[model samples]
Target: MSPRPSSPTIPEGRDSDGVDFRNVVGILARRRNWVFGVPLALCALVVAYLLVAHPAYTGTAQVFVDPRDQYTPKDDPLQNSVPGDGLLLVESQLKIITSNEVLNRVIEQMNLQNDPEFNGERVGLGRLVKALIGLGKPEDRALVTLRNLRKKVTTRRIDRSFVIDILASADTAPRAAALANAVATSYLEEQAGANSAFQRRTSEAISAQLGKLRQEVKRGEEAVAAYKAANNLVGARSRMVSEQQLDEANTQLTNAKTRLADAQARVRLIETIEHGDAGLDAVPEAMQSAAIVQLRGRLADASREEAQLAQIDGPNHPALQAARAQVRDVQAAIQRELKTIARSVRNTYASERTNVQTLQANFDALKTQSQANEKLLVPLRELERKAESSRIVYESFLAKAKTAEERQGIDTTNIRLISRATTPENKSWPPAMIMLAAAIFAGLTIGIALALARDYFDRQDRGPEPDAVAEPDVPARAAAEPAPAFRPAVIAQHHAGRLSALSEDLLAAPQGHTMVLVQVQRAAWLDDVALQLARAVIANEMDVMLVDADLARHRTTSRLGFDKAPGLRDVMAGIAAINEVVQLHKPTAMRIVPVGLSAVAERDPRARQALSLAFRQLRDFDRVIVDGGEMGSTASEFGLYYLADEVVFLAQGPGGKSEDAAILVDLLKLRQVKARVVFVEPDVSVAA
Candidate 1:
């Protein structure tokens, strides 16, 4: 056996595949015409479209939406029960702007059905295409045209405002503006017509109600008149007669009673004065009499003259006697006047008592008559109240009816055409440079997708992968020879330089050791590489043990033509001993282990330990080469890497997927496994 050398360190430059700028440049350079031509062609087509395309002009008209005030009842309790927000009303009006009724009117007024552009029957590329496809039918053409016309006319409500912008587009500058203005005007006319009709109907209803109310008022007044006539009550004063007479009677009775009380008091005073207990000066009536006052004055003069005579004249003098006689005559006159006044007061007292009795009797009779009249007037008063209420209602309805009739003649609309649409100054669509740029970008994207798709399909139809099928009849001597002799012509030429470089380093590796060949990429061709390495070891006259560790697809075993042979899988599963699966290569005379179909070998807990023990048994051979399919792709492959002395990772080239290999390398390093990477280029010679 040869002495084993120290483990080899993979050079940093050769650790994993790196980016090859040359490869990308070669791809683009090979398809240079396609890369440049597609975008330019598309840009030219777009420029042609912009130049020759029919330019459309857009026109806009602005209209204001004014919400009409809803008639609110002044005394109704339910006026606020429903939603009356003007926002909702405004929104409703906005919807009505685009309604079928309004649009139909606009269409009729503009005579748009005869217009080819609005009817969708205009001569154009789309129409020609549809004609060729036999799609345009005459029966549905009107509907289709109407639908298309509606699309051209759009109404937009200004944000947070009640203004709406009506936009219309057409082939001609004036037509676009005309259509916009026509739609707005038609909407306004429709609203006004609707309001006028409503007012007319309302006026008719009010007139009918007013007629009924007038009849009711007339009937009520007639009934009240008849009631008065039937009771012989005349004039407006008739109803108030009983009440007025009772009031007057009460007043008269009260005055007469006052007079009677005064008269009685006067009579008492007169009687007292006449009895001589009190003087007649105490009588109010006598004092008030001018005759009594005159008599008293005369008596006062006589008393004074008498007092003078008594003071100055002799006892029997003639002047003294005459003064005495004058005083006596004045006293007699005053007494006679007081007695006459007292008798007249008594007569007035009796007369006043009789008058008070008559007034009291009249008041009582008037009160009785008023109470009876009040009872008779109860139903009449109710009829009067009803008549008054009906009259008021009738007057209100008459006023309302007059107003509605006046409004019916007047045309009014809440919507106003604040601004009319005008002829467009410039084309609204197909900005030349911008459209050209977009077309160029789209063309480039489409070109790239086509290129990638062509490449993918070409690869798919390029027959099966060279390494996908296993070779069951290749002689062992073919593998032991140089790559050109046994490998396929495609692989030999492409991998010649890489295999040559790898051979020198691999041949210098120490003998009597295990080598694990693992492919980190999915569905790789690492097994073929392992076969070549095994053959090379055998060529050195060493006893090589080639173990087909990949049980899933026994590529090595197939190449060796030992499918029926017991192999490593049997030994791992404890179904067969290690010695039982070992066989010698036909031409190379090297020991080989075929992969047998053994179930549960992967799930065996002691599979790794058993594989390690199997490796130890293989130590007697000059070298052991295990084919581990893919490292992360299979779980059983990890045990082979642990059992091997050195691991070779085969990576596919021309891709930036080194991260996957790097992760595997890190994992292997953690397990204390030494790994080296070998990059195999698929189209290396073609690229070159």
Candidate 2:
């Protein structure tokens, strides 16, 4: 048995196939013309475009809508649009700034309808291309000019701010600046007009309401007057006449009652004096009389004289009688005065009572007239209140109209210009640097893809792989697994130079089979030689198989890691089929048929016929290499030698000069099997 050679160790970051980075670098180098030419061509095209294209200048103007006041309710038109959202308000204003109403004014002011840059009247390469493609005008000439101008003008708001930016493009810097300024001015004027109109509408509305209120005030005042006249109500100093008279009558009634009470009391006093048993001394009139006073003095003297006489004489005395008569006379006189005083008092009381009664009757009549007038005063007071309210409302509306008119004249500025457009110093169209960079990037991507595609086709055009790879007859499960015990091409290619002559010495198929027999003869490199020879034959564009039919030793099978696998012995003993036993190596594209269970050839009488039948099944391959056991005296020791048309003897082993190999060689000569001796140096690498 021989030992297999050690495999080369793979470097880090590189596979057994090749280095990935080197493969990429190599592909670029091989297709260098494409890689460089494409980018240069694209750069040239960009340069040509930048040179021939029109150079347009851009001018920018900024207009600020004072967010504090622009969104206020003072202007109904602007306020009603995009309410409560500040950001949306600014965005909507940007749209309004670019609207047709504003842009049309700019067009008229700037005479853009006749400008070549905006009017579509100028001829250019783009226009010529469009014309060639039948892109004729679809509207009137002035309409086309307006559409073109609109395309050249754009409006946008600054982020998170109320400032709007207006941009215009033109063939000349001054024209561009003029167009931008015109557009800005037009937008500001439109906003101002909208605000003015809103103010005017407000004033008109106030005036209309004022007129209605004035009519209401007049009607309310008229209603109060009509109510007063209809009920016969009269007033002096804003007071009813009947009410005044009733007040005066009430005062008089109060005085009359007092007077009547005093008079009745006086009358009662007189009657009480007359009916009572009291004397005229209690009477006031009697006390004030001079006649009673004089008679009282005379009666007092007579009573004194009579008392003196009555004590001295009897009832017939003349002096006593005379004194009694005088007393009687005085008493009667006093009685008559008392009666007169009573009559005078009674007359005075009666006069006062009559006057009080008359005044009470007059007061009662005044009260009834005042009560009727009071009932009519209710509606009259309500009408007065309404008239006062209507007058106040009319004055308020009138004041509001005046205030709105004043505001409309003063607050006409809705937008202010933050920045005016200036003549640009450089062209904006056909950006040279950016275009060149983009062109270079695109060219590199396309060039790399095309190069890779061409390289893939070039590899595909080469011849197909050997039969071992073309028709892999492996099991379904083993399709994912790597080839069994297959050595890399690194080892095969390393040994290819030493085995080149040996590959030529391998005999072609004589008539029916391309089977070549090899006798190891104690060669330590038996497995290595057989593998290298098979790989070399495959590289020569031939399908080849290496068979380890040396059943006694099974060196190739043991070293190739398939010693117990089904092989020639299994095929010859009816244990396995030839297709099932053949092993295909992926890395070297070498097929090897291993020897298994050699005892079958010795014990089974039909083993020879089975072996011949197996060899016949393998006739489709271009070449078959059989590893016979060490050389021996009898041809029976090398069972596959009889089937082979050629035999190779390894000269490095003792069996090459032994008597047994000599006898076998002569027998091979007699059978006319072409035989040769190959001297192979022993391999230095240890088998894994």
Candidate 3:
């Protein structure tokens, strides 16, 4: 049995495959010089760039926010105090600063519009000189000139600050400073103009409103006066007094008529009683006097009773009738008394009538006086109405006049600057230093990446040593010890011994030599049948020399473990003795000869010579097995046909076409080689 191959031991303090941090570090450390050098070169390049770049002179000017001129307090009635930020006003001011109005003013003041520096046309002093010397075109000079112009002017705002810095660069420092100052002055002037315009508009509006209000006051006064005059309304107090007087007079007249009617009624009542028909005037003497007096007394008593009865009862009552009977009797006496008194009363009535007429005349005079006073009140009422209307007008106008006066005097001092712009001495662009630093950083990063990539692509093997004597399809396993080296001549000796044994088995048959089986590998098809035939002949105890004749792509000899042997080529070339080339294995009783070194077999004529000599020597053995190279090669067919006793054509099953095999047989027949062809199918067990 062949000795098993040994296994390699892995070192501790390393990965399972023997890789370690030290190995990785070694790779990077080897490349450290490049990594450091690359970054340093980048930094040097940055420095060189900075040195070659144009030096710009930036001139700046400072301007105060000018609280009174730029920012004005908002007049919002709902607000009590001014807003501190006034963002809208600040934004408007910023617009004015950058506006064409300010820019145009700056351009005019500095003679910038016509100056080549600000003109859209390009021009340069260097190009102009070159043109004068006939070295440059005028248009090219103009472009250079514009480029220089663009470098001179710059403007930007400070970070979130109210300051806007205007910068100008020029060949001379003074011009740059002058340009910046001119821009700032122009901006200031623009601000002043804007404020003046706004104030003028406000003043004009207020003056117009004041004039209209004054006219309105005059018209309102006239209207109020007209209303009062039309209505004839005096003062409220005078109207009330007139109404009270009329009411008093009406009451007095009503009372006087009531009294006159009652007095007249009393007079008529007395007259009616006096003229009644019953007469008691003649019965009133002493006895007549006694009787008449008594009658008179009774009559007086009856009259009193009638007066009481009238108060207590209606005239139709029975009690009232008794009273009336007495009253009739008393009325007869009263009629005598009244008739006597009536004459005197009629005379008195005539005198009273005159008095009544006199009283009525007095009342008529009082009425006339009251009418005259009411008539006199009308003009007074008109005058009072005029006075009231004039007073209303005066009051309303007085309020307006007071408001206007207050507005005129109100102080505008609350408008003040909240923030001031400061002058900036340095420019805010082309941050070269930071850019250089970033470039250096990027170079270092690239260097590291390149190092890692280089390590990945190189395919050299690394780690622990391999264990097996032969590297097989599977990984190597541990064995007790290694196998011994093989000899070259042992293969031929084993073939000679196997041929002697086969000669013994064939003694009964005409004492002739046994049939030799010579198998060859073919190209266009794999030769599993050849391998199986070799195994079967060996099982029969016949001598078999398995000659691997595949000279191109030497696969068969390598598969048989005779890759290191020298055989057919040595004998063909006469370089080595025959016994030294063939190799034998005693344990399997198998002799095998590989086609000699790979170089000899590639030359077609030499390969054919080698095959012919090797086949001629095979007659010494009982039976020889030849692995001819693929049928595709002419050399394998020529050499094998001349040498073999009987050729066994081996083919792979499920192999492509049988044309090569059939053609080989026909070719052998044409040559009249003494050989019988036998087709062998590939054995399934051996193939698997």
Candidate 4:
């Protein structure tokens, strides 16, 4: 036989197989009445709400931000370091604006809590009902009141500017403006006062430090003065002059004493000559000269030796004896010579003695003068001490005076206000147009979803109702001839027997030769019937096979706890050989051959043609229970009706009075199917 042609492809835009934009438009057009009505009604409601809603006026004040306020300048002497951007200051200000301190002040100033309208005004019964239904809460009433008041008060940064816009709203415009202005003024005053306090404290601290510094300066000056006074430091020039005069006088006195001693020595020599030393002339000039020369040489040698031995020997060494003897000889010779000379020069000697006496008197006078000069040093030292004291006092007082002068200059001026708050003129709220547009869009989207969902759940098939015979695309040879009619008398007798006898008769059919047919009024009822029949057939102890003929909704395998298997559909399509697709249910002693398990067949036109071939291959089972599609469904009427030998129509008593059942019966008769209709009654006793 020639293979059947492939199923026709569903055209794009076709309503049956793809999204129908036209249907979508039609649904939307149909719902247009509600669409327009809902929005218009909502718009009216909004308008009514606005009309009844309390009128709120807003007032605003401009505040300039001072970023520098929270920071200390680098040059500021008293400032200490802190972290973060000065934005912290702005944040602090924001907190203060919303603080309980500010809020309480506003409440008290406006007498808001006591004002009935601003508190809890009477609410209508409609609002009460909405509140009970959770559409509203009583807390919302309080919030609304607060919001209404809040509307009279708002603070925002001005666009692209550091200034803040403080706005207020109220039932009365003036009050709203006033409240806003008041809050702004209060905040500004508070900030200004804080700044003033900070400045005052800083100034006071500086003042105290300055006072301490001044006292320190004074004490430092006094210390310097006392030090100078104690040290007796006269002016440098005066001290130098006095020291020069004292040195000059001492030099003169030393010179005078030297002359006086020279004169006295000469007189002593003259006296020795006059005392009978005329005989000294008898001595040899050479001897006298030699003696004097020797003594002088010896003394010179001894002094030189003594100087060299000063560190190692005493002045009394025996080496000095020759010098002493030589000195004595020289003296005796000098005395003799002097006596001889003196006899010849008595007048000269006497004159020498007078000069010596005069010289001694002058030496005494010089010594006295030196003593008097040394005495003057005490008074000069005293004057130096006094001068040093005065200089010290002057320096100390001068240093203190300079420090005090610097301290007194730290007064400065009071901190000044750099900016003032200004009242604002406009209100911000509602966003009516945007909200309405969003609502309309949401409503339409919801409406479309509901329509599609309704269509999806409806069970009616759309077109080309199921017919008795396969379509012309299927080969005639693949179609089965009508089954031979069974005697109604024989079936009725079998049905009237005891349930156990019926079971025995079914089981007695040759071990591998049995057939069970189940028909239902609709495709959805098959699962329950198939399960019941499957259980019953398995209980007969004959191997059973079940076939699902409902291509539109193939669920038999799933219900039998099998995943989709390539069964009857593949055999009919010639894609799979029969034995390969036929799955055996081992534990139950049953085999299940489901109809087309391919999800594709539901929309394929050749599905019925393929199903007819699948049913032809089912003769191998010992007993076959076919779960054909619903009697009224197209798949059963055209694809499965001729395949069954004996068919049973499943109904539910008077509940099966729908036109669907009547049409199914007529279709079965028209197809010449030898089927018996059975009504199922609910067993109340078993159900309970």
Q: Residue-wise lDDT of candidate 2 within 120-143, one digit each (tens)?
A: 878899888888999855557678
Taken over the whole model, the C-alpha lDDT of each candidate is 0.70, 0.68, 0.51, 0.50
Show the colliding residue pairs in model 1: none
Candidate 2 regions with alpha-carbon error over 4 angstroms: 1-18, 70-85, 216-397, 412-414, 457-688
On TM-score, the leading prediction is 1
Instruction: For each candidate in turn, give its C-alpha RMSD to the true structure in angstroms.
Output: 12.5, 20.8, 26.6, 20.7
TM-score of 4: 0.38
| Model 3 TM-score, 2 decimals | 0.34
Model 4 stretches astray by more than 4 angstroms: 1-3, 12-16, 19-48, 69-85, 100-152, 158-161, 205-554, 564-688
Residue 273 lDDT in candidate 2: 66
Identify the leading candidate in terms of lDDT: 1
User: Worst 10-residue stretch by lDDT in candidate 4?
Assistant: 679-688
TM-score of each: 0.58, 0.47, 0.34, 0.38
- What is the C-alpha local distance difference test score of candidate 3? 0.51
